[model samples]
Target: MDQLAAMATFVRAVDAGSLSAAARAIPSSLTSVSRQISALELHFGTRLLLRTTRQLALTEDGRIFYERARSVLGEMKEIEEALAGNRREPSGRLRVSAPALMGRLLIAPLLGDFLRTFPSLSVDLLLVDRNVDLIEEDVHLALRVGRVADSQLVMRKLGEVQMIHCASPDYLARRGEPQTPSDLAQHDCLVFSDAPGVATWRFGRDAGSGQRVRISGRLWVNSLDALATAADSGTGIVRVPSWQVERQLAEGRLRRLLREHEPAPAPLHALYQPSRLGSAKIRAFVDFLVERWRGSDPLGR
Candidate 1:
């Protein structure tokens, strides 16, 4: 089988939604398109697509193969363009990793527009809560939330997310609002982290490296949404990233607190392996993110 040609036909057929559509797009006979796809399935010893008279759907194996093949083809096109000295429009596959909740809430929504801006570019986004090794995960780029201590990879600063101090009006009504970080010591505080210990909330200070006060609460939740819900129900004061609780603050489900003592916002960064240093697609995406956050106030500042 002509492997590359077969893969190309398979991809086109999938994209065009039918063998006849693929045939028209490839400017080839329907028989030839059909033959190529069959060759691919035979070569792989697996059925790539389940076809009905009206539509096509990929099998589990087929979807995986499609993504890999698309990435491979995209890279080949980029290599050909570079060899021919074509104008660089930032083409090819970009594998990006980001934290799960943050990625969905922030990064994923911007991707449709990003892809529209650079049509030749394809993204493979991996959303996982844990930090991914760029080289191990085969990621070309990553959007990381919070403080980054990974000095090994190339990093770009992409602004920050504010830590919003908030509580319910009823909570304050029952237990008076804390005026300062130190005052939080006397009130119930809902800790967002997973461990049981003295929880620390920081406050920005004019003359020093800010203030840290230890507080204890009746409830602590690992999930951000759950933490917000607990705070909304007047459980206790919760400090969370502004992005997660912004809706509650806006709708008055949760009321902001300690504006004067708000801690310095946690930073966001784009990280990539050293091998990806010269990649145009990675550069374009990072620049796009930096611009997207510039003076846009995602932190609800």
Candidate 2:
């Protein structure tokens, strides 16, 4: 059996969702599609799919093989492109994963311009609040906020965003503004959480001088929008990414506070699975991001 052809056929089946669908896409017969899948299963010595008339599901081994197959196929294509001297222009479907809030706020706005600049390229942006496996999710690149440490993937520094403390005019009016990070203990704070509650807030110019102030709050919420809105409604003061409240700060809905003690700016990064043969699209996008974010800090820390 021709291994590459078989792999291509198996990939098509997974992409198209069924044998018939795959056959239609390949303009080959359903029998041929079945034969390729059978060849793959036999070669791998494992069941690739559990298929019935109505549905198709990949087995555990099948799922693993599929992800590897995709990366292998992509690398092969990139190699071919490089040999053909078509590598200068990025021309393919580039899949990206990013945080929901940052993607929607900072990255999404840049998509149209990037596409326009590279007419041959297409993009798919997947935005979620959690970490995603690039290979498992078929993501070509991930634009992330915060410090990421991963040995398996390649990382590139982009820029940083300030994490600032802010409060509404009414909240400050009622409870009085904090004179120092130490003073936060006397006031209601809008806590951000992944768990049940927050017990402290950290502040400093650097790691050596940093301090965490023990604090209490009436509201403990998980959502960024909700946290900002809570602060805006005079519910409580919050520590949030400065970029998140650009409009609120400008319009005086939320006033910046404790600037002298705000923590060091969080770094932004572009991450991707390592490849011997790199993706032009990934390089182009990363370069675009670096170009856009240079000498800018959420529009101050």
Candidate 3:
């Protein structure tokens, strides 16, 4: 059995969602496709896929093998591309993942120009407010905000995002603005789960002289949009990323407070696997973003 061909066939079956679909894509007979899958299962000593008339589902071992197969295939592609000097003229489907808000507001706006510049390239953008593993998810690159915990991936700094404390004019009028980090205790704060410091707000010019303020709130959620909306309606003051409320602050719908006490800016990064460091698509996109955000503060200076 040709191992690599069998693996490719298995991957195609998973991608196409059925044996018949895979056969159609490969321009081979259904029996040939089934033979490849059967060979792979026999070689592995476990079933890789479960098929019904309607669909194909991966068993637990199948799921694991699929991820490993994808990673192996990606590495093989990179090796072939390197040998062919494809880095100079990137031409493939580049899958990118990014945070939902940033992807929609910042990254998405720039993609059209990049695509126009590189007509040979196509992009698949995935935006969600969560972390994505490059290898596991088959993501070619990612736009990550704040600290990146993955040490294996190579990170390129694009810019920084500011975290701001702000409130609506009505809220300030009724409850008064915080004069210092200490004063936040006397006011109502909108809280969100999974926030960097959900119960403690840290402020400083640098780590050595930082102020830590413990906080409580009447509202708690995981949605940044909802928190901003509540703050707009005079519900409470919120400490959040500036991009979420930049327009509100500019149009007088929200007022920034304790700007001097705001924490250090969160760094934005473009992350990719080290093996993809030589990829033209990754380099081009990262360069475009750095140039686009240079000397510009998304939080409104």
Candidate 4:
């Protein structure tokens, strides 16, 4: 048995909560994953997972083994990466995750340049609006927006994203533009429901001194693209990151409203697990993105 492979499979199953999910992620069959786990259990003469009809739970021994296995696997990866470094070229799959809109508008364009620089490197960009478990998913890096919560992940601030309240010109022409926060109450709003605290929009002079306003909208959508499309179709006013609607504002498709009452800038960060920071692939990718986005107009600042 390939002990390292089995260990990886076991860890993945624990993280994914099922052998089936782990198998799908590794692009293997569920039976194969189960067999790998079973093989590992047999080798140790102990059961690690408490199998059930509904859910898989870790036994007490399994929890201890899981933590130790992760450390061992991480060290092995580190050793292999270190040995590979003598070749003096970045070579590996870089798994990255970012918000959908930013992924589309910003990161996608820069990927070509990145790949060209490191010919041996390949990237798997997972664009989704929700946060991902970096360790469980084996992601090398993540591009995150908004105030980062306290966590074990190491983070570097690339810049801040300025948000603006905007509407299509046609809609503004018909309903009139809002001059202040109070005026938003009278207008139909397009809310990005996926964002945290969607029902209450907050703005302030700085992070601390702020006003929170309860808002209701004619339309609420989860995707940024959907919200942008709604605003373009003149459905209602929408609040979006300034970078996203800059072209629309310039092209006369959209107009910025309530300019005086802007929300606090949401900080954009590149986050990675600390354990992987020394790996050549992770380090190179994070540096590449940070160098590309720093002091630039990714957020129209």
Candidate 5:
């Protein structure tokens, strides 16, 4: 059995979740894929996957090996691409992840230009609100907004995204506009439960310098799109990233409120694992995005 081939097959099977799915991905038969995984397990003298009737789960050892295998495969691919004298051209699969709303409104538009420039490059964009493990998921780059906790990953600050408190004109007319942060308590506030333990809306800098306003609301949502929708329908006032509500504000669907008392702008970042940073494909894609955003008004500052 070819150990390298078996390892590659095993990694694919683990990622695809099933032998049949992995076979289909590699354009091979299920039997062949199964044999490849079995050979890998035999070679290593341990069962890598715990196979059940419904699903395939990884063993602890399998999980560790899977991560290492992915890194090795990525490095191998990079080496082959470099040796082939195709390093100058961005020709490879690039996996990217970003927030759903921001991905659609901001990043999606830029992809067309990127693809045009590098015709041989293929991109898989994962639009999710929740944070994903970049190395574990094999993602090349991730566009993140707000504060990032992972200091190990390489991060490049693209720009700052301002948080704005906005409400529909109709809602303001009926409920009246709030003059200060303290007045928000009396109004129905649309809550975004994306961040945990946010029972009270913390406004301004610190505990003393900033005022912690405990606001109540009937609507609670996890997605920015949903929260923005509720605010547009005049459900209540919502504090969201300015870019998310910029279009609505321009169309008069939403109006900014308490501009002077708004929280500090959250910095947007492009994060990637250190291992993949040197790869031509990864560098080219990130540089392209940075350049594109640098020229735009939203990311320019």
Candidate 6:
């Protein structure tokens, strides 16, 4: 048996979850795929798969080998691409994740141009507000808006996202505007329900000293867009990323509040696993984003 070919076949079978699925993926007969896996197991002197009529499970050793096989196969592909002088032409499905609001407002709009630039490539963009594990989720890249707390992942700073507190003109007219961060206690502040005390807004200097205000409100919603909408409709003061409230602020629907005490701007970054650097697709996509946001003041600062 060709050992490397068998290893590649085994990795494909593991990813496909079934011999039949693997055969279909490779456009080969089921017998051929099964034979490859059998040869691979025989070569290793261990059963890699616990096969049943309805399911396939990995044995303990199979799991370890599978991980190594994947890494090896990926490196081999990268080496081949580099040797073939195809490193500049990235081709494959690229999976990217980003915060919901930022993805919808900014990244989503750029997908068209990016795809047009690289017709050989495809993108799967996941937009979610919560943090995602890049390795576990199999994401090639992620756009994060806050501090990157993970030490395991590699990060490249793309831009800064400044947070802002805003209220609708009508609401400010009725309830009066807050003159200080300390005065937020007396006003209705919309916040996320998931974040118990998100209404407790913080403001500080770049030097690290900051003050936190415990705020409460009549509207407690989970969606940032919803909070911005409620604020635009005169519900209450809503603190959010500046980009989210840019249109409202420009249209005079919402007014920026407490500019003298806004918190330090959070950094935006493109995060990925170190292993992803081997993929030309990931490198190209990240480079495109970095160029787009670099000096554009993405935070609307």
TM-score of each: 0.66, 0.85, 0.84, 0.76, 0.78, 0.82
Ranking of predictions according to TM-score: 2, 3, 6, 5, 4, 1
For model 3, the local distance difference test gives: 0.85
lDDT of 5 by residue, 50-106 (tens): 987557999988989899898778867866665655437878798999988889888
Per the 3 Å backbone cut-off, how many clashing residue pairs does candidate 1 have?
Answer: 0
lDDT of 4 by residue, 176-284 (tens): 9887787888898888875444388777667677777788888888887888889999999898898988888899999888777787788888887776656787777
Q: Positional deviation of 28 in candidate 1, in angstroms?
A: 27
Q: What is the C-alpha lDDT of each candidate?
A: 0.81, 0.83, 0.85, 0.84, 0.83, 0.82
Every model: Cα RMSD to truth: 7.3, 2.9, 3.2, 6.5, 5.0, 3.6
Worst 10 residues of 6 by lDDT: 78-87
Off by more than 4 A, model 3: 16-24, 27-38, 50-57, 82-88, 194-198, 295-301
> How many collisions per candidate?
0, 0, 0, 0, 0, 0
Candidate 2 Cα misplacement greater than 4 A, ranges: 17-24, 27-35, 50-57, 78-88, 295-301
Can you tell me which runs of candidate 5 are displaced by over 4 Å? Answer: 1-6, 9-45, 49-64, 79-87, 194-198, 205-208, 299-301
Q: Model 3: per-residue lDDT, tens digit, 106-200?
A: 78988899899889889999998888978888998998888889999999877777888999999999999889989988898998766444487
Global CA lDDT computed for model 1: 0.81
Best by lDDT: 3
Q: What is the lDDT of residue 72 in candidate 5?
A: 76
lDDT of 6 by residue, 1-301 (tens): 9878888888888888888888899878989988988888888899999987655899998998888787677656655654545436888778899988889988998899999999999999999878886755667789887778897887887888888899998999999999999888888889866756445667975636798877777788878989998998898999889988787788999999999999988888888776555567877888888787667756675
